[model samples]
Each structure stands twice: as C-alpha cells, then as structure tokens.
Target: MSAPISDISGEHKVYLRFLGKARHFLFNLRSFNLTPAEPIPAAATKAVEVSVALGCAVNGTAQPSDIAAAVKMASQADVALVFVGVDQAIGAEGHDRSHIGLPGVQSDLIKAVLAANPRTVLVISSNAPVAINWEQENVPAIVGGIFAGQEQGHAIADVLFGDYNPAGKITTTWYASVDDLPHFHDYDVRKGRTYMYYQGKPLYPFGHGLSYTTFEYANLEVTASALKPQKAVGIALSITNTGRIAGDEIVQFYVHVNGSKVQRPIKQLVDFARVHLEPGETKTVSFALGHDDQALKYWDEAQQDFVQEPGKIDILVGASSADIRLKGAVNLMV
Candidate 1:
C-alpha cells in the first residue's frame, strides 16, 4: 500500500515522525503497535473457536432485533462471552466520565443476553472501573479485561479457559454503584479514595483476586516485639499451595498503628512479596522493617517539618487487606 500524500516534507517524512513518536512513547509504556505480532503458539488440542456477537453500541439507539439475534446465537452455544465496557470515546485520559455504568445501553444488552443465557461471562475492557453488581450476581464469571492492547482478546480467552491461572489482583476498590464513590472533585485519597481509606463495602476490594489453586498460610513469626529507630525487625510467614494447580501468591504486609495523634490510614501496605508455589509446595516469605519502614512521620502543624511519633503498631500479613490471616504487634521505641 502507498503512504498518505504529503506536501513534499520528504518521501518518508510520516514514517520518520512515527519512529520519533514511538521512541518517546516506548518510555511511557502507554502505546504500542499491535498490527505486527508474532504468531501465537499452538493452543490446547481440544480448543475450539468461539463466536462473539456485538449488537450494542454506546452512541446508537438500542435495537431489539439485534438483541434477539444475539440471544439466538447464545442459546445454541455452550457459554456466552460479552465484551462490554467503556472505551477511549467514553473513558479516556484528561477526561472525566459522566456516569460509571457500562457506558450506555451496554448494560441493557447484558441484561437481555442474560435472560437468554445465564452462563455468560461479562468481560470488562476499560481503563476505569465500572459498576458490575448486576452481572456479578447473575453471571457465572466476570473478567476484568483492562485495556490490554491488540492481544487483549487472546489474553482474555487464555484466562477464561483453564490455560492460565490468573493471580493478578485489583489495584483500586470497585464500588457497587456511582453513589458508593466519593465526590469526583475530591482528590485526597484520605477522603475515601482507595482501599486504604474507603469506609463502605466495595464490590471487590483492592488486592482481591482468585487463583485456580488455593494457598494456606501458617507459622507466622516476628523476630522482635519491640522496634528501635535504627534497628531492624523481621517478619516471616509460611505459605503452601493446597490445591491441584500451581499459581503465584502476592503476600501483602500491612501495619496498623494502635494509637496515634495524627491522622493516618486504616492500614498502610509497607511491603509485599510475590511467591510462586506448585501443588502442595510450601515457601517461607520474610520482610524487614527498619527506620524507613516503621518510622511513621506526619506533617506537624506546630512544627515546620515532618515529625516521627512512637507508638505500638500491629503487623498484619495476608493475601489482601480483607484477607489478613496473621497478626503481630511491636512497640516502637524512639
């Protein structure tokens, strides 16, 4: 194919400009070319092609006939997979969404399809989180297909099947509705912005995800019951995969100050370790807390600089904040 007709900037001026943009954008990791891709390796011998039907549009009027056709296609299939979510047009950078539902009649389409086939998987492919309360209640599975570029479909398919044991956790809190979220203008995370500060029950709390396999925690140990300003304290815990498949577990460490004079988050994540374990395999993960890790400092109004306050803090470890399993306390000695 021929290139776009340019006013003699050069024969390949457009290509040169593209290369320059690619060089700079590669550093930010926000953009990539998916037109060129390496051939995907062989799939499972039993793998078969699945049909996807999209009759919902964000800007157009809802068509009953389109929904009827999709339902007919779904009724014959073993399972239905719906890829519905906000896109660049609805949710984008330097812009704010007016509402947080599935963008438009996409939610309506989801309901219609569910009426025909309850064995539906709602795959959300958006940059921002949207309400999925209805689907979560009725659908068999919900896949968070965050804008994963060109190979997005392949990645989604891999997870939908048993080929990939996804252990990735959500980074932010997912609410049941827009009403559950804080005011859009409130930029302060302390004002119920994230899992660390949010007060209400979230649809899916931060750091929440399920693996194909299961892991059990045991033998939690803390090296010291007291903390010195310059001394180091260690915390160790054992994790075992008690399921049939192998997977990775992110061991999160959070600390809650028992008594504090200044405002603080409910619990702050100080450290984390990602450990991969096979079936029935066990591994001990450990983390250390030194001056930088345990030294809690807050901006002092009376004083000009940040000041450290000595207090007792509880060490909590688990897969997620809502799943804390082990607990230990250490008195901070200044």
Candidate 2:
C-alpha cells in the first residue's frame, strides 16, 4: 500500500484521495489481462460529483428563463431560497442607470416562481436597491445582501440555516420607480441631491429591514434639553425583542429642521445602531449628534468651516424613515 498522508488541506486531500482510488482501480484492472473501458474525463467527472454532492439533479445550464422553471421546481421542494438582484449592471463604476426595473425578464421569472411558491424566501443581492414586482404578502421572508463580500455565500447559508440572525437595515431608499427619485441624475449635485432633497416617495424608505423577531422601542431620553453650537447631544431608547426568535434590530434617528435659511430634505438620517437581542431581551441603544449632523455645510465669508445656526431640530426615532416610532424635539441655541 502507498504511504498514508494527513498533511494536506481538506479540499486538496479530497481530490488527492479520489486520484489515489482511481489509480488503484486501474492498476487492479491491468492485472486481469483485460483492458478497461475508456475512462471518464476529469472535468465531466467533477461536474457529476458536484451535482451529487449538492443534492441537485443537473437540469442543464441555467438561462434567464430557466430561473423561473427552477423556482417552480423549488416550490415543490421542501424549502425555497431565491437569490435575486441586479449585478454589475447597476453596481460599481456605474454612476446612473437609464431604467430601474429588473433586467432581462428577471422580475418576470421571480413573479412566476413566487406565484407558484408563496412560501419562498427572497434574498436580494445588489449594490443598490431594486424594485420587486411580486406581491409582498406572498414572500415568507426577504433579506437584503448588499455586496456582502467574500463570505457572502457562507453568511447567507448560515442565516437560512438559523445559524446567524440577520441584523442589517437599508442604508438607502428603494424607490417604486426611477421617476420617484429627485432629479434622478442631478440629485447629488453641489447644491441639491440626497434623500433629503428628493420629493417623490420610495418603495421602501431608508433604514428598513425585517428581522425574524420583533423589537419594541420605548423610554426616549435626551441628554440636553437644548443643543448648542459646537456641542454634542445624546439620545437613548430601550429596545426589546417581543418575538420568539433571537435577532438584531437597527434603530434609526432622523433630523428635521423646522425652518432654515437654506432648504433641506423632508428628513435626514443622522445616526443609527444595530443591536442584538434574544427573545424578550431588552437593551439601551444610544447615539450622539454633533455639529456635523445638525448643521448645514455652507460657505462662510468670515469663518472658514461649516457652522451650525440656531434652529429647531426634530429627532424622530423608528425602524425606518417612514415609520417613526418616537419623536423628540430640541432647539439649537447658536
């Protein structure tokens, strides 16, 4: 017998061991004085092995339309996890897009699959937001995976297996259509552009995400009755998960100035926190707001840096921009 080896990495060792077995079988066949049939090609052999390992029957290569058929098959399976999102088309390097709908019948595929499988879970993978056409009530769960790095696949598998609870929230709005966005292209110009400048409605407002569990926020408190220029203020709230499963909650804080020399968006996200909680667990989450968040950066003829002006600032706390659970007001005395 050949010398046994244990120093190889797991994946490397698996292939090495397969090669060893194949060689042994071929050697034994030679001793029978009979030639063996043509051996299978390594690439083809690997493909078959991988398919078997994944418990997936090779249904041929997946085309854009095949996604729908796959979903139909998944609907019949025990569980369905659909990974849907825009890839390089709208992510990275691209500053703007001509249209904002699902590309190449992807949405149509999702709709067909979701119709057939109401219990499916949608894991949205995108660098930016997307408009999902399917009925929201039909999907059992939805998770946003925002360019989640190298370990994305592992992280997703872990979440689906209940090994990791999703705790992330939306950083930007998911608008119903491109038209809803303010100036679609120029919103971020020198003077105007941002969620605060936008006029129309978004499909899903910023800082919005659903967890496996539920969380309730209460007891809103602020460190200072009034904010002053060049000073920091603390805002705290208690969050308790009322659901059965353990999960993470993202608490968002928005600021709205009653009146200002310069115009402002309807609301702006100033601070946020992601807190983990077990069932019936409660924790205090807090964040500090400084001159940067409260003040508008304007060119000053005398003073160089951006300055804060006296104004009424509204502090709204909630799960999302559209869902403010609590509200507190403070006047900044410049």
How close is every model to the real structure, measured as TM-score? 0.83, 0.73
Cα RMSD of all models vs. native, in order, equals 6.8, 11.3
TM-score of 2: 0.73
Q: Which stretches of candidate 2 lie over 4 Å from their true place?
A: 1-72, 89-91, 94-96, 135-137, 183-185, 188-193, 291-305
Candidate 2, residues 168-257: lDDT per residue as tens digits?
777776777766655654545323234565555567777777777888999999888788767878999999999999898889888887
Q: Candidate 1 clashing pairs?
A: none
Name the regions of candidate 1 deviating beyond 4 angstroms. 1-47, 58-61
lDDT for residue 61 in candidate 2, whole number 0-100: 26
Q: How high is the CA lDDT of each candidate model? A: 0.75, 0.66
Q: Alpha-carbon error at 245 in model 1, in Å?
A: 0.7
- Cα displacement (angstroms), candidate 1, residue 257, comes to 1.4
lDDT of 1 by residue, 1-334 (tens): 1233433222231111122233212112343322322344476356455675666765324578777778888888888877777655665656568877776678778887787888888887776788878888888888886646646656787899877888878887888778877788878888887777888888888777778899999998989888887887899999999999999999988888767776677888888898999999999999987755633556688888776667788888988878898998888777
